[model samples]
Target: MSRKYKFRSQDDLYFISTATINWIDVFTRSLYKDIVVESLRFCQREKDLDIYAWCLMTNHLHMIIGTRGRKMEHTLRDMKQFTAKRILEALAEHPEESRHDWMLWMMERAGRRMPGNDIYQFWQHDNHPIAVFTPTVLLQKLHYIHQNPVVAGFVERPEDWLYSSAKNYYSSDLPLLDVLLIE
Candidate 1:
């Protein structure tokens, strides 16, 4: 892992990008997306996470976050672990899922490839955390995060994306996740 992506400062906000193992599009289902949302809510309430911005896509997520009581890395680790287990369970419960078998096999293969993984691996290992040191960089990352859904053709407007904080920035409509406004 490069030091550039490592958690080095507790006070600075970090822009983090984490993806599903193999970019398997696991978040295409509402059930799986809800699991990630609930885990993030738990982390925010219990893990001292201050989310400034966030976007949850079909296979990955991007966020700008600051931590108060716990290290940023530790909080993210717990979130990922919890969500992985929950999402795997969701996959099992939803046999109607068209991609169920293929998705499970892909995750299982990913787990076998990694010595540290148990029977499955849901998320890719690295968060690619980049410390946001300047207003210019922070703004840049925020724009990129919001623009993801639009660029991906999932939404016509950034604020129209329900899974992102773009609405918080661009509209009066409340976003699915509460976020601290950047100033």
Candidate 2:
């Protein structure tokens, strides 16, 4: 845990990115991606998480988030832990997951290299959090988050990415997860 990326202020919004261990394309499957979406929804509904924007890519996720009641760090920790466990379980139980064995091996190998992991590590330790202190920076991060899928050639337009808040921003359809619209 690097102090540099630690959430220091509870009220301030932060842009954070959490990657899969070894950058494995774990989220290429809809089951894994649904796990993340449901986890975020859970955090928002039960854990006082305030999500302004989010994007889920094949291997990583980015979000602009803050906290209202609980500490942001704690909420984030719970989200990551819960999601990791659920996603790993889903992978194990998924009958059609062709890369299940290879994915588990990679995660297990990465987990063994870490100190606290008991079996496997799903998400990388560092979130690479950047405090969104200014409106300019917030917009920049929002643009970056929405454009990730486009840059990766997953979509021709940012709003075409169903896993992001860009749809909520650009159209009337609700986002995959609830989002706090930024003004």
Candidate 3:
């Protein structure tokens, strides 16, 4: 097993990207997307997590966040794990899932490839966290995060993406985190 790197300080904002296992398109369905939103909401409400930015792609997520307590690492871990379970369960129960067996098989193969994870892992374990130490870097990271959906061709405008915080940033009617808006 590889040594896991400890997360940075809880009080400092960090830019993070966590991908899906094998880069599978897990968030293509509303059920899976809801799992991610609920996970983020749970983190903010229960774990004292301050989510500054977020965008949910088909198979991954980018976030800018900080924690008010020392359990930010655990909060991220638990959020991903919990969402994975829920998302997997949704896939299993989905009547219209055309690629169900294929996805499950791929997840199983990935678990086998990983050294110690006994179950089929659904998320990439390594989260790339870039510490947001300056206002300039913070705005840069925010732009990068919010521009993801637009760059992916999922929406014509960033504010049109329902699963992203870009709408909030643009003063649109979307339910998103109360991000620290930067002018």
Candidate 4:
């Protein structure tokens, strides 16, 4: 809503955080998380997105991202839209989801209260995109992103988190997402 959060320049990389409506823990399951992973992969290949660093938490995703082709806002918008629909379907069909009805109900309610989605709103509208201007800010955001799971007590080490790019940074044999290293 303010000039500070707006994407002013296409050439500048931004540190972004997109969270779920009502802070729902939709990504507690790997199935839903994979949808985001695949979407990021698609964006990297098809949309010319440059993902420098990223981390996926239970409810929010943080990334230091730039793009060579598409507008940063558009790339994020498309990614969120596709992931929302696909993850909702996965929630509907997931046999082991204990909170299936509740999660969908919350998102639907949020949608009604929010501006965009007609029925259900998965990601909260504001991306909180902060332009990454300096090497210091980039490193700070990068550390914050990778250490999210560790700070949240989800894992003992940043690389222990299966869904984060820390694995890729830490020489993990198989990371879920491939990131362009800034270091």
Candidate 5:
């Protein structure tokens, strides 16, 4: 991991993107996306996470996040671990998941290639965190996060994406997770 991507300052906010292992398009399903949303909500409520903005895409997620009580990196690690576990469990138990076996096999193969993981690897290890040091940089990242779905052709507008905080920014609709709107 590069020093630039590591969370260095405890109090500074960061823009981060976390991707699925092998960019597997794991979040094409709503169940997996909901797992991520709920896990982020749990982190915000109990793990001292301050979510400024977020967007979930087909294979990755972007967020501008800060921390209050816990270390940002540690809280994020817990969130990823918990979300991965839950999503894997859901994949195993989902009766209608046509790609369940394939997804598990891919994750298991990824886990074997990685040294730290015991069985499966859902999320890639690197968060690719960029420090949001200035208002200009913050707004740039905020736009980047919201524009992801548009760039991906998932929606015509950023706020139309239900899994993102873009709607919260416009007060268009309530988002899946509460966000601390940037001013």
Candidate 6:
């Protein structure tokens, strides 16, 4: 995955997608979901990020966000690292998660196999942040993020995806981050 090698710029509205290492479905449990939400909430409160839209699938996440104070890459990096550690900790402390040992083994194997990464490599190193350079691209990413659940047959409409901002985008009542919605 050789990139063309462009430096990351400030205030880049990124539609980022990072998959779980080996595509492990680590987010199939509620505990994992809660930790992710908590991480996002904490970052939003403390990191000065503008979260536009987002979706949490079984093994990956799609987010549209930008930094207001810090660098976008730094903000995203912190969020990913924090979530990985917290999720792993929660999994280790909970004795009720059915795939505890299996999950731990997979994460450990991934950590060893992942080159130049920490011991708990839950997410791929590449953030895959596509800078939203055009209005059309931004809209397309928004639609794609919102439509992911429907495309995966999880729901009939984008608004039906509870983990996504589609509900907030459509209804405006869901407790979501302040979005940079284009008219």
For lDDT, the strongest prediction is: 1
Candidate 1 global lDDT: 0.89
- Model 4 / residue 27 / CA error / Å: 0.5
Query: What are the runs in model 5 whose C-alpha is more than 4 Å off?
Result: 1-3, 172-183
Best by TM-score: 1
lDDT of each: 0.89, 0.87, 0.83, 0.87, 0.88, 0.81
Candidate 5 RMSD to the real structure = 3.5
lDDT of 1 by residue, 5-65 (tens): 6988898999999999999898887888888989999999999998889999999999999
Worst 10 residues of 3 by lDDT: 174-183
Tens digits of per-residue lDDT for model 5, 1-183: 456579889789999999999999899888889999999999999999998899999999999999887998898889899999999889878957988889899999999998867899999988988999887898789889999999989899898999998887866454333334433
RMSD of each: 3.2, 3.4, 3.6, 3.7, 3.5, 3.6
By TM-score, the better pick of 4 and 5 is 5
Clashes of each: 0, 0, 0, 0, 0, 0
lDDT (0-100) at residue 140 of candidate 2? Answer: 87
Tens digit per residue, CA lDDT, model 2, 51-122: 899999999999999888798778878989999999988987885799989999999998999897899998
What TM-score would each prediction reach against the true structure? Answer: 0.93, 0.91, 0.89, 0.90, 0.91, 0.87
Candidate 6's C-alpha runs over 4 A off are 1-7, 115-118, 172-179
Return the TM-score for candidate 5, rounded to 2 decimals: 0.91
Clashes of 5: 0
| Winner of 1 and 4 under lDDT | 1
Clashing pairs in 6: none
lDDT digits (tens) for residues 71-94 of candidate 4: 989999999999999998888788
Task: In candidate 4, list every pair of residues with a backbone clash.
Answer: none
Residue 53's lDDT within candidate 6 is 88
